[model samples]
Structure formats: C-alpha cells, structure tokens
Target: MGVKTYDAVIAGGGLIGGAIAWELARAGLRVAIYDRQEPGHEASWASAGIISPAPEHPGMIPLVPLGKASAGLYPRFIAQIEERSGQRTGYRAQGTLQALFAREAREELSTLVALHHGLGLACDPLHVEEAREMEPALSEELQAAALRPNEACVDNRLLTRAVLEAARRSGVEIFAGTGVEAVWQENGRCAGVITSAGKTAAGNTVIAAGCYSAGIGGAGSYAPVRPARGQMLALRSPALQIERVLWSERIYFVPREDGRVAAGATVEYAGFEKKLTPAGILSLLEAAMELAPAARDAEIVETWCGLRPDSPDHLPILGPTDVEGLLMATGHFRSGILLAPVTAQLVREWIVDQRVSLDVERLSPLRFRDAPNPAS
Candidate 1:
C-alpha cells in the first residue's frame, strides 16, 4: 500500500500539541502527534496551573494581550474539555491574592497598584486585615496585599489529560513513545517528520516539543529553546484551609480541592537536569511557610520538577518560520499552561485558514533570525 499521509503531524504531545491536534481534528483534518514519551507527563503535568494574565515583569508586557485573551477563553475551553472528555479539570476561578511581607510592603503595594493601573490591568489593594480575613492562614507578618480578581487556576494535570483524551476521541493518532527526530523537508518546503520509527509524511508540521524542541535536527534555528528547571513541592494541610491562590515575592501557593497546597518553584538554569536538590525544596518550604505560617505544620505530600522552555528573550516563539509549511508553537516558558488555548487556536488558524486572528508578528520565529543569540 502507498504511504498514508496526514494533514498535519506534530512533535511533542504536551498541552500545546495536544490542544492543536484536538482543534484540528475537530475541524476535520487528519492529524497525528509523536511524543518521546507518554503525553501530558512533562511540563504540563508539573505546572502549578496559575492562569494569571498579569505580566509578572515589564519584559512580559508583549505577552499581556495574548495572555488575557487566553485567560478569557478558559471558561468555555474548560467546559468543552470537560464535556468531551467526561472529566473535570479542577478549574478554580477564585482569583489570586498577592501578599507582601517586607517592612516597606505598603509602599511596594502602592507601587504595584500604580503599575497595574498604568497598564490598564485590574488590581485592587486590600487592607492587611481584610486580606488575612479572606485567607486566615496568611502570616501575621503580611504587611499588605492586593487582589487580582480575574486571575484563576486549574488542575493542569487533569486539564492536560482531558485535552489528550479529547484529542484521542477526535481521531488524532498519537504515537506516545515515538520521538520525532527532525522535520522532513523536501524541495525547500515542509513535509512531516522523521520519527524514531521512520518517516511520517504530512501536509504540515509543527514543533511544540517544549525544551526539547531544539534537539530535533531541523528545528534548532527556528526554535532555539533551552530548559529552565523549576522545582516544586506540595503540602497537604487539612486544618490550613487556604482558599485563593497565594503569591509572595519569592513563592506562590495554589490550593487544590483535595486539600493539597502546591508550592513552587525555583527557576534555575540547570540545562535539562530534572534533579531535585535539598536547597531547592528548602527554599520553597521557607517561602511557603513565610507566606502562610500554618504551612509549616503541613505534611510534605509530593515533590517534583519541570523544565520550562525558555527562549533567548524569555518570550514565546510562535507562528510560521522560513520553511513553507513548518510552524512553531514552543518557547512558552512559564506561560505554557496559560497560553495553550490561544496557541492552539493560532496554530489551527494558520494551518486551516492561512491567517491568525491575533497580531502575533512579535511572536514569530523569524524575529529570532536577526537578533543576537543571548548565549553568544
């Protein structure tokens, strides 16, 4: 029999690839995903699931619009995923509270509120008394706090699995253990992938392999992604009863429905090493207990790490590249969970409609070509 071809073949079966495959398959396109291991077991599973669109730093300003758009799309996205996958994503829309503990916390909070207002973002300064009332587990040292009422969180592990299941139900063929070694290029155009099993031809190809994207032979230039290792631990405290997601200058706590508060994450540039160190866990615990003193009594339930895909400028690399039909949707770094819906929508739009709804020119992979490599 002649080789069977698909409409699209994607590398990396994480949130980005799975979402794109589900979207495309729902649009009636033949799609396949090749992952190095079981889907949704990578960064997607290890994420803290904070879905805030607020720029964490000034450098993240460009991502604000996209992040907000995706955050807005989340309710419907979760509803659809739940309906299709028959599983709840543990989506919590209770918003987030950022507490400050420094001596000059009131001044710092004023500056933070001003920054949010200047950026046209929603941020309401909360009296320390009111903040502590809302979350009684908060430390008595909490000098000030602000509420981002629109920020939300989800159980990313469940969401990833639901998306993967939905993709499977939509008839997207998934090759879990099959790693795509390179993009199959022919006559100056994109084709499909060179997988460990062999060649799989398709009309289009996408590299969404997270930190491992650069390892795929023909993808390094367009997706020069490196791994940023983040170590996280989970604490279960039945008596703590922390409701909203809590954020301090050092660490953040995400409370789940199952009585486990997930605290993370030290951003270390350790180059693909997923090892958890004593210092990393200790720092996380110190920050967690500092933010909520009650956490000191909580039981350490779990500890893990994930490698976020970091680009040269710490911005996501998206959209079409020099190759005709090869597209990129990697380098999301910390925002992969937040940007998955928008990224999938943009990728599907590009492949199926030849254009994206959003002005993603700044996120294009071509922008990297003219820029000096940070490592150099």
Candidate 2:
C-alpha cells in the first residue's frame, strides 16, 4: 500500500506547529502534525505565557514589526480558537509592569522607555507611588517602573490545547508519540517525512520541532537552532492579589485569574538536560519575594524546565528554506506565544498564496548559510 499523503505535514507539535496546522486546515488543506511526545507538553506548557516585545533584545529590532502584528491579531485569533475548540485559554489583558529596584536601573529604563515611545509603542513611565497604586503588592522601595498597556498574556498550555482542538475540528490529523526520523525527499525536491510508524508524504513540509529542529536528518545545517534550557516554577498564593504581569531584571511574576502566580525563569545553556536545579529555583524565589514580600509564604506548586529553541541571532527562523517545498518555523525562544499568530498567518500566505505580506527576509532560513556555527 502507498503511504498516506497530506497537503502539509508539520514536524513538532508545539504552539507554532499547532497554530500553523489550525490555520492551514481551516483553509481547507489536509494537514497532519507529528510530535515525539504529547503535543504542547514541552516548552509550550512550561512557558509563563507573557506576551510583549519589551523583553526582547535590541538586536531583535527586525522582528518588532512581526511581534507587533502578532500581538494585534491575538484578540481575534484567541477568541476564534476558543469558540472553535470550546476551551478557555486564560487570556488576560491586565497589561505589564517593568519594576526598577535601584536608581541606576531606573535611569537606564528611562532610555528604553524613550526608545519605545519613539517607535510608537505605548509604554508609560510610572512614578514609584503610581506604580504601587497600580500593583499594591509591589515592593515599596522600587525606584521606578514602566507600564505597557497593550501587553497581555495567555495560558500557553491552555492555548496550545485549544489550537490543537481547533486544528482537529478543522480536519487536521494529529499524530502524537510519533517521531519523524528524517525529511524524506525525492529528485532533490522536498517530499515528506519518515517516522517510526512509517513514511508520511506531503506536498510541503515544515520543521517546527523547537530545539530539536536542527538535528532532523536531511535538514543539513539549514536550521541553526540550539537548545537553551529555562527553568520555571509556579506559586499558588490565593491571598496575593496582583492584577498585572510584573517584570524585573531577574524575574517575572504572572498573576493568574485563579490567584496563582507564575514565576520564572533562568536562561541556561545546559544542553538537553532539563533537571530542575535548586539554584534556579532559589534565584527565582528570591526575585519573586523581592517583588512581593508576601509571596515568600506562598506554596510552591510546580517546578519544571523547558528547552527553548535559540538561534545565534536570537530571532525566530521563519519562512522558506533553500529546499523547495520545505519551510522552517522554529527558534522563537521566549517569544513563541507572542509570535505564533503572525508566524502562522505568514506561513500560510507563503505556502498557499505564494507570497508573504510582510518582508521576512531577515527571518529566512537562508540567513545563516554562510554564518559560522554558534557553538564555536
């Protein structure tokens, strides 16, 4: 018997891949997503779900437009997914606060605020008292803070599940616990993927396997993604009434509507090992306590690690690859949730419509063809 073929076969069933599957399937394409484990249980579940461009580096300026575009589409995008999938994603628009503890950091933040304002992003500098008024749980000794009113967050794990459900509703075939061993090609053009179960053919293939993307056979050195492990913990504090996402230089606090606080995360290049270290938890807990002293008594509910896909330049590797009919949409690092909508929309445009409305040349997989390996 011939192997079953799909219009699109996506490797890696994380948020990016799931979103693409939902979009493509909704557009009447027969799509299938294969993941080695349960979909979205990896980095997507471990994410803090904060959605904003503030935390990105200055070098990621090229991606700002894409991030903004995704942020703009999130409201409608999430609502549609929820309606279609019949699941709530815990979406919140309470905004975010960048807290400054010292005078030096406050001074530095002023420049960042100015830059953001110049770029037309809505970031307002807040007086210490005003900051306290907005988030009464904040430390009283904070020197300064800034508010990004447009920034929002969603429960990424819930969102992932919703996307997967919506994809299924749109007739996308999902294959969990299926690892694609290689990109099966013929006549020098991209074909399909080889999985432990067998070969699955597709007219176009997308490698969205997160940190494990670069290792997929037949991809060669196209995807320069590497594993950057991040550690995070959640605190269940019913009494802590925090309204917005709080950010400091060291840690971030995301207040869930159910009174749980999500605190994270440490960026460590410890390879594929995802052990939860005590130091990682201590540093996060200390920072969380500094932001809200009462949180010290909060019960630590969960601690886990995720391997984020990090490119050398730290921007997402999206759009087409050198191989025809093959695409790449991994290496989103911390901004996976923030960039999912735009990535899906653009990928759909490029694959089904033959062109992307946004100029994503910098994000193309071809950018690192001549660049030296990041490990060196």
Query: Pick by TM-score: which candidate is best?
Result: 1
Candidate 1 structure quality by residue, lDDT tens digits, 143-252: 99999999899999999999999999989999999999989999999888999988998998999999899899788888888999999999988667888899999999
RMSD in Å for all candidates: 1.5, 1.6
Candidate 1 local accuracy as lDDT? 0.91
- Best prediction by lDDT: 1
Instruction: Tell me how many clashing residue pairs each candidate has.
Output: 0, 0
Estimate every model's Cα lDDT from 0 to 1: 0.91, 0.88
For candidate 1, the per-residue lDDT at 277 reads: 100
| Candidate 2 lDDT tens digits, 1-376 | 8898999999999999999999999888999999999998888888999989664667877777888889999999999999999999999987899998866977778886988886668888988899999888888778889999999999888999999999989999999999988999889888999998999999999999998888788653667788888898888865567888999878998877678888999999998898989899899989988988878888988888899999988988888887888999998988999999999998899889989999888888888878765433
Q: In model 1, what are the clashing residue pairs, if there are any?
A: none
Give the C-alpha miss distance for residue 247 in model 2, angstroms.
Answer: 0.6
Clash pairs detected, candidate 2:
none
